[model samples]
Target: MAKGKVGKTVESLGDYLREQRVASRLSLRQLAELAGVSNPYLSQIERGLRKPSAEVLQQIAKALRISAEQLYIRAGILSPDDGVGGSVELAILGDTGLTERQKQSLLDVYASFLALNAVSDAEFAADGDVAAEPVATDPPADTQDQDPQKITTEG
Candidate 1:
């Protein structure tokens, strides 16, 4: 990432963290204790004077009862698109029972599903229809006698 971008990300992440902490009604020291980090370290993070590691972000997220992926996005560690599988990815990463390889495999599979859905959504959008009905076609021979008012297309 560019230096400027990184700086902006860190600053925004700090601001977001501060906002979450305040919204949770936790003081700086209280949040620091809950996150198991030093008060000064947390203060520095909130001030945008330090870039925290992923582990730290997770801890803070847990303390704030928010999604770690949100922090990851703000920190520029994960793109917004990646957030489609945010909580699932975090669970996979945090699971101690699964080996790293297993976690990676699961993540890959999950990502493939998200990608496939994205493609389908794009195609649907390109069709310029808000509904999911199929293209119009001739009525079946057996249904030709049915009243047109009784016919319906799936949405």
Candidate 2:
């Protein structure tokens, strides 16, 4: 594969994953077992010689007991989503283990965290302008009122 910005990002992701694994005190073989991937494959991923797919990143994140969205961001599978934590919100909503109440609680906390960060970001901006950048509160143009299963093609 051509080594470019994406390649560099994947390499950084590998470094990040290795750091997380070391911080969790799990050996490479142990992490590989937990992630249900072969040791050599995981080693190649950690060494930045291979770019893992989103599914692999999810598995590794689950094994690491961390947010899959975090790994997704590191892997460049998804952008920051205007810093609103939209992907994280979706992941939390899609989680089968969390009850409705639990999901609501988590969403509440996540929203509060975002609000706090927005305030801090505003404070650091010139003249503490909260509206420095227009917030993207709307859904993407392509997805607005569209069915998830349906595909639209423009000729």
Candidate 3:
């Protein structure tokens, strides 16, 4: 990405983080306490004076009760169409009733379901005729047509 674009993304991420924090009714000191970061550091993050690491973002997201993926997208670590559906994930993350563990569990289950469906789709595509072919462990290299802009994330 261009330098200008990156700067804009960082600013946008800062704005988004501030909005989430305010929406959760968390003050800077309270959020910093919850996220295990210094009050000044959290304030710097909200002011776009600092670019937080993935780990810090995760902590902040947990404190805000939002998805880290949302933060990742806002930070330009992942694009809009990177892998998951933003809206669905955001909805799950935004649900105040669900605990952090519950949200993570739900996301894991949802991701597993999507992965299984991908495998099934690949198998069906491989077997032109319906003859109950065995599923392959590895998908074809060209499976899903391969997006060059796709961002890969490691657990």
lDDT per residue, candidate 2, 1-155, as tens digits? 67898788888888999999999999999999999999999999988888886567778999999888888677665557646666676676567797757866886787778789989877688565445577669778879888877966879
Best by TM-score: 1
Per-residue CA lDDT of model 1 for 7-126, tens digit only, reads: 888889999999999999999999999999999999999888899876788899999999888887798656677645577777776777987578668877877898899999899888
lDDT of 3 at 128: 84
Candidate with top lDDT is 1
The runs of at least 3 residues in candidate 1 whose Cα sits more than 4 Å from the true structure, single-residue gaps closed, are 1-3, 86-155
Tens digit per residue, CA lDDT, model 3, 28-137 = 99999999999999998888888886567888999999989879788765457635556566666667798767866776686677679989999889888886658767
Ranking by lDDT: 1, 2, 3
For model 3, the run of ten residues with the poorest summed lDDT: 77-86
Runs of candidate 2 with Cα error greater than 4 angstroms are: 88-155
lDDT of each: 0.84, 0.81, 0.79
Which pairs in model 3 have colliding backbones? none
Ten contiguous residues minimizing lDDT sum, candidate 1: 76-85
